[model samples]
Target chain A: MKKFMNDPETFIEDSLKGFALAHADICDVTLNPSVVTRKSLRREKVGLVSGGGSGHEPMHSGFVGKGMLDAACPGQIFTSPTPDQMMEAARLVDTGAGVLFIVKNYSGDRMNFEMAAEMSENKVAMVVVDDDVAVEDSTHTTGRRGVAGTVIVEKLVGSLAESGANLEACVAFAERITGSIASMGVAFSSCTVPAAGRPTFQLADDEMEFGVGIHGEPGRRREKIAPTDEIVAMLLDSICEELKPSSGSEVLLLVNGLGSTPLSELYLVMNSASKWLNRREVAVARSLVGDYTTALEMAGISLTLCKLDEEMKIHWDAPVHTAALRW
Target chain B: MKKFMNDPETFIEDSLKGFALAHADICDVTLNPSVVTRKSLRREKVGLVSGGGSGHEPMHSGFVGKGMLDAACPGQIFTSPTPDQMMEAARLVDTGAGVLFIVKNYSGDRMNFEMAAEMSENKVAMVVVDDDVAVEDSTHTTGRRGVAGTVIVEKLVGSLAESGANLEACVAFAERITGSIASMGVAFSSCTVPAAGRPTFQLADDEMEFGVGIHGEPGRRREKIAPTDEIVAMLLDSICEELKPSSGSEVLLLVNGLGSTPLSELYLVMNSASKWLNRREVAVARSLVGDYTTALEMAGISLTLCKLDEEMKIHWDAPVHTAALRW
Candidate 1:
């Protein structure tokens, strides 16, 4: 493999070690190197926690800072963290205000986070997100899986928690925000796990994989590669159909790159998505375009649209200080 | 090639259209679409004008905000902007204070920017950056070509300009700071020019290129891919040997990813680079890790080290607002 790694089996541990060392100002590690906690915390505010597999950098770990995830427990690449990791992270962040876990909608994650909440002595709650309207079921997931909207959920709800919201209020906001969001992705090529040393899936040089999951799993369909506008139309059409926003309604838009896609391409996607929304008379309240939730070295882009209300808009505009998704 | 693009001939223009729409709050295109100027400007300060080829998003264009470049003139993909484009940008940003053109050391860019300075009426000075100690000459450049250190130049000098430095003062600091910087890069694959319809160069799956230029030009040598530490050793050693910072020196380190490289790998690069500097007893005053200067869709990383002084540190810590490289 041409990857910049020491060993396939030890990639996650080494990555986290380096991550903690590099971002010491904003984060620190606990007894378990896999669990990252914010360097500073508010005693009277609800504690926020989020995590998933290791390949998606800046997802859970990079988001652990002042205005985002309070603690993150990362697993191996494309694998869910164990309940023990979550339990330890829960204990680290549990002040008198209580703790909330932002869990994605995959079976392993769903089961393990549930186990952690049940097994922990602290009062724990989770808001499971399933905004990917791509497929109802997938290889590693049960119903519609969580995708890029997880970034939005963390950004919006994390800000609310920082505002000294109670645990119940944070949980309710997470659920409400996730319910109004829809995400879909397309991949030009698949990614390889460091241990596997080969791609998880393959696409011909001229073909594309539409509605791709974050783990390089099979999507809704594969099709011949098309122009930028047509490809954007297909993804936005699917999202717009599900969202059904009225002419005067406003929403927040996210155009995220899946690992290896260029920023230029992501900007193009935003440009196209904005034009489409304008033509449909749907006002876009705020827009974020960058690589937030990514598959390791996967070449693709994902789009997430969150139908917004006034509360979410104000929370979204609040100052967020994190390694990623900073304003 | 599997890229999200339409009409290769018009890709640059189309991409800029989208970029302007996406960042309308901070930037806009001048009458000449190739010139992107900050929406708000300080007329009394020296106007910083930077331009080069397109494809490297968030570099020239993304840096055009309150404390960075006053205007950025982007050429077609991997091609230098014409004298006319630079002249237009120079005219747009020029107030009572003169304009400073930060040019990378490519032949086309050097020639075109020189012509633009001569052909314009505004008081203009050009500072050429050749910090890439990779080779004395390359495909499109003369002397040591400019690489990621251009980002450092733009950031530090631009902030200085915002503090009301005159044209001569900005030019002197730009040259002094650029002189202390050194950079080197490695690429696993060559980037394709959209109009060319193929990668600029070829590499076997297990082989890698060291000292590769930002535009897919040949480097000092090609070798079989090795472990991350060994690869980093070669890059850092080469940079250290040329710049030669002493044991008690302070420096700002940058680990920049070529486009298409994952952030995880970039972080590892920073981790490795940091450790190497520590072993050498070199104190890193500041560090930045991400894709700042990129060959479109190339997989590799570059290492840049700038010997920092007290003035540079203070300017670096000053509040600067831009699309990329914000604190």
Candidate 2:
């Protein structure tokens, strides 16, 4: 696999400089040998910060604006951002109103963000988003994992913070959204990291992996390419059983395209999902279909659903602004 | 090339459903087929609608919501949205305040959106963004093409619209930003469409394509990989020449990663760009780096710069809320 770069080693530093320059209204940078934090100031509003691997653009950093993260820590590629970086962001965004760390369920992310929270001087609230229903349903998995569903929790909670809701309110709102959401992903072919210069995993052309991790880690099962309906059924069955929302509950359905999957294929998956849910009489009040949280250019898609209440709907309606996510 | 979908044909449709379900606050779908429209009801606001091929997520559709597009017409993967679909969106969002079409500078996109605009109500206004410096610099091209820079124009213009600027004012602002911006892109490998199940084009292991189109089409030049500084120099030379900003003019730089390029690599390119610009005494007011407009995870990046006037900076800072972007 060929890739584009002058020198692979200098990629991160160059990208950060460009990010800071383009988003000067919202993001600033502090660079030393040690840490990188996007300016996390929301004035007198309570701040929110999140960080992890750098590959997921529009996540930690792209979200550093109003109605979202006050600051973001950039890690090296898919590796977790350093605790020191998160701590710096925590310090920068803490306006005495406090700061909330929106961490994914990944072990590395949890431990690092938690450490940063502990080291923070101002009040630090922690919310871990473990919304991947796929991991919990896998008979062999040790614990539930976080995936694209983490984005929803961040948005709901971020809006609360942007509106000057207290830190405790933001944390509770984040946790609540986390519990109500679930996600599952599959990959057709592994993405080749520019630095790695090859696909992350090997799969036959006719085979696809289900329950795959975003970073290209091995998933629970690898199987032949199934029909769209079959694939959607399997993914939904796992997610539905995990969340077990009642029939009358309003659900926000997400048919997320993994990095390389085309929107056409994603829409087909959504068709299947809508049909299946309709058959079950599940009321989907609203739906989002796009590449919200991506896994490089992996050719796959994930399904995320947030069972909604009145409050969740209101929260969802609130305005939001970030580089990649706007509403 | 391995891909994730069970069937390549279904990728776009499946992805759209998920996208619609993922973020419901700013977007909703029309059932007969699939068209995403904004939920924010600003009755007197000029509705902006954008759409094209499906591969460039967070582009036409992801940008639908308040402070940006009022609706997004999604077409099949890599194909322009149908004129009929565009007409439908044009009709739905036009609430007497008239409608504006923000189209990219692609032959298919230009023709389709133009046809749609003509077919729709005469009150609709249309603007085509042609801002890619690479396409313009190549005399062989028909006209300067639009790429990621179109997004900046959309955001800046959209914010102006949301701030209650009239259609003429918004269109004028968009035109100015478009005039001030320049972009160039390079790719290492061709992206494989899921249905095609192969690379879009072939690349030798050490080769890179410079001045490539957004769909991984062949670039203006194919050469062996070089150092990061040299690469940055090449891109900056093109952009700097195209945008002859007055001495001491402020700039907003965007270094965008094509799908699979790592953020680390993007940052490296940004750093090189900054040093190069600083040596020339260009004032960098803002910088944005990440995967804004992607080509199905192609391992490459593009650089876009907007010469900022005070008004442009204010417009850029105006709040926006869209499904895939919020600021």
Candidate 3:
């Protein structure tokens, strides 16, 4: 595995060290429990917190800042963070308004965040996001696995929280987003975990994995590589089937790169997705194209579609300041 | 080649179409002679224009928005844009105030921008950036080749232009930035061009290309892969040799991913770079870590350091609202 790392055990810590320094203006890193919290705390505002495996960068950690996540707990690689980490993050970010935990639908993540919420002293609520329509069950998840659409949940729900929503309101909006969004991914190549020191899976040069999970989990099937439009159609078809937006409905389309995919290719995917939606008479009111949630160095792309209402659109357009995401 | 592209001939146009759509709020795309221009032009402000090949994304095109390049022309992958594209872009952005062209130090790019400036009707000035300290001369350049440092030049100079600096002042500030920054890169694997249908260069599984260029140009040497610290040391040594920064000097450190490298690994590199700079008593006043300029889907990282002065820091801290960069 050709990776720029020293020790696999220290990979997350080292990367976090750099991350803290690089974005010191916006967030601070607490080492023991590995919690990243916003530099300034807003009093009486719902504290939005989310986290998962470390491989999906710019997710929970990079999303910590004004108008986004209040804090984030990072686990090791594809492993879930301990309950203590989540508890610490909640404590750091929670003001008088209480805290909300945005947990992805992974067995490990769900369990850990649940434990944290149960033991927390502050009023805390949890919203499990299972936006991935690729599969009902996966290697690390029991139900549909949360994938790239978690970014949409974090951004929209975080915006609502930033607008002084209470903890219950934040939880309600997060659940609404989780139900409205769908995502599916395709992998051109598998990623190498630092500990594994080899690719998670192997594929011939002409093959591609469809509906793959974020951590290289098995997808629906494998087939010979197809044209860009066909590949995009496969992912979008699954997503659209789940969402099933009616004609004249507006939505936010996200073409997210699962590490190693170039921005140009992500844009290409976005272009094809826009065409597909237009043909179906679905208006794409908002679009995000780039690597927001990545799986190590995997070469793939994920398409996320969130059926948008006026409330969601207002929140989605709100200003956000974070490390990997800022506007 | 496993790329998300329909046809190699239309790769650039298709990607630009998606980019324009994705960032419609910030910029617009003009075809025929493709140019990405800011959505709202600033009348009487010196126009900043930059362009080159298409593969290095977010460089010339993604940088086109408020407080950055007023316009950018994107050519075919790894091919210089034609003079007409530059001329057209200059005409579109030059509102009363003269236009300033920021050209990277490449034979074709320099020649084309020069021709465009000579044939233009509006007042024009050009600043050629050659910040690469990898080698004095290379395959695509006459002197030192420009690399990731071009982003620094564009950001700092673009901020100056946005602050009502005239064409001559912008040119002077760009030159000052061009002279102060140094960059170098290394590639673990070569990227395939969509048109070529194969990798541009091959490396043994355990080997790496040191000092590689954005277009897969040969660097100083190739050797077996080294540890992250050693690699950071080597690249930093070359860059520091060129700059000879004093111990107490402050600099903006940028750890840029070529294309396919993960953000975690890039942060790991930044961690190592910070250590190296710290050992030398150099203060990192500003930091940027991620893919700013890329070479298609190449797996590599580059380090760029620009010595920062009080004025430069003020401009660098100014607001910028571009597709790839915003604050």
Candidate 4:
């Protein structure tokens, strides 16, 4: 697979060791339950938990720390963590306040997290994020699949939870924020699954996939690779087609890499996206561009736009400290 | 090239625009001089400036913020910036405490920064970083290439400068820190240069290059693709072979990707490197793992180790806010 891993079977677990060790002071990892919780939980704060399959680093697990997630329950590659894992995380991180689970919109993730919420002793609120405007449904998902906007939801809601917001308040904020965002991705090549030991899909030397899913699912359409300006305009047009922010409306822009796309390409895409927005008269108030959400070293970029209001802007700018996404 | 860009000739400038706009809250970007400096400079703090080719995002520019570099001058892809860029940066950033130029160990970078220092009005200390233990000399470089160790030098020296270290003091610490660091890299594939419109090098599907340079320069040797454990072992052994830390010495480990290498692979490399260190009884006091320094779309990881002492540890842990790194 051309990946730096000893064995495909052990990659996820061994990667967790690196994740835990990298942020040893901030997180305490439990292997059997497969949960990573904050080292010191707040005594009276609503606990925050987010999890998904592996491969998307700096998303769920890399984000467990102060002013962000209280715990992250990681599943295997692109697979949902079990109900037991989420229950264990809730039990470990819950204080006198309740617990909130940030689940993405995929069917497996929603099913597992819902059961985990009902099984937990503490009061729990589950907020499902479904912000990808790529499609209304996908091959691996029932509804619109949650994409890069999950990172925004976690940052905004985690900031509120850290500030002593109740479970309902965090859930409301998560829903509002999730509703305010949209994402669309462009892929230059398909990714390789470590276990599968082959490329997930094939592309010619001059082809690109538009609206590709994060898990290497087939995108909405394929076409000959175009110039950067054209590629960016198409992605932004798809996102804005759903979100439909009017002229002069303030927004937060997130240009994320699918995986193998380097920062140069990411920034170039951001540049074109910015030009795209500027021509439309939209005011970009805040921007977060990087490879926060990925598809296992796939060559692509996803453009996520978060329509921000005054209150949302405050929460978005709040301080956060994690293994990744620190500010 | 499969990169996202409107045009190869305009990619660097447009990408810089993305960079400036991304961190608009923190930086002031000038087009003619191609300088990116802090919006607000601290008077009496020694100014730190580092710059090189534009493709190395977050290295010279993503690092221009509080507690890191005061200004950065980005050249075209894989080319050294001119002296005028550095001179303009020094002119704007210097607040009467002079400036420190952190130049990588490339002939073009050294020559250009030296010329800029001679021409600038402000007192300057130029510290050259040559910690790549790959080979004594090779194409595109003389002596060892600076590689990823420049990030360490900037972080340490930049922190010291922010604390108001004088020019001489910054230079002394820079030399000491530079002497105590070593780096080595491994590449699975060569990157494509947009300007060149072709791949920099070629490799068989089953071959891997060890002791590679950042700019896709040839490595010391190429070997058959091996298991991840053996790959990490080779990289760590090369780095340790040069630095030769005592058994109990502590270090700050930096596992950097040469762009396109996903975080999944970066952490896997870190996982194996950490295991390698434990077997040798070395202490990892601090770890920074991500794509800090990168060649554009080069699929590889570079390991940098800075043997830390009491003072260096304190400075390393000190808070610094930048586009790529914030705490």
- TM-score quality measure for candidate 1: 0.98
Q: Pick the candidate with the highest DockQ.
A: 3
Better of 1 and 2 by lDDT: 1
**Higher-DockQ candidate of 2 and 3:** 3
Pairs with steric clashes in candidate 4: none
Quote fnat for model 4. Answer: 0.65
lDDT of 4 by residue, B1-327 (tens): 688887888888888888878888888889987999988899988999999987777788888888889999999889999999999999888999999999999999999999999999988879999999989997867898998889988888889998988999999999999999999988999988898999989999988888888888888899988988898788788888889988988999999988877787787777888888988889888999999999888888899999999989888888888888877
Best by TM-score: 3
Q: What CAPRI grade goes to candidate 3?
A: high
Calculate DockQ per candidate and list them: 0.67, 0.37, 0.81, 0.73
Judging by lDDT against the true structure, name the best candidate. 3
RMSD of 4: 1.3
Per-model RMSD to reference: 1.3, 4.7, 0.9, 1.3
Give the DockQ of candidate 4: 0.73
lDDT of 3 by residue, B144-224 (tens): 998899999999998998999888888889989998999999999999989888999999999999999999999999988
- Model 4 TM-score (B-chain only): 0.98
Which candidate, 2 or 4, would have the higher DockQ against the true structure? Answer: 4
Residue B317 of model 3: what lDDT? 94
Give the lDDT of residue A56 in candidate 3: 90
Query: lDDT rank, highest first?
Result: 3, 4, 1, 2
The clash count for each model shown is: 0, 72, 0, 0
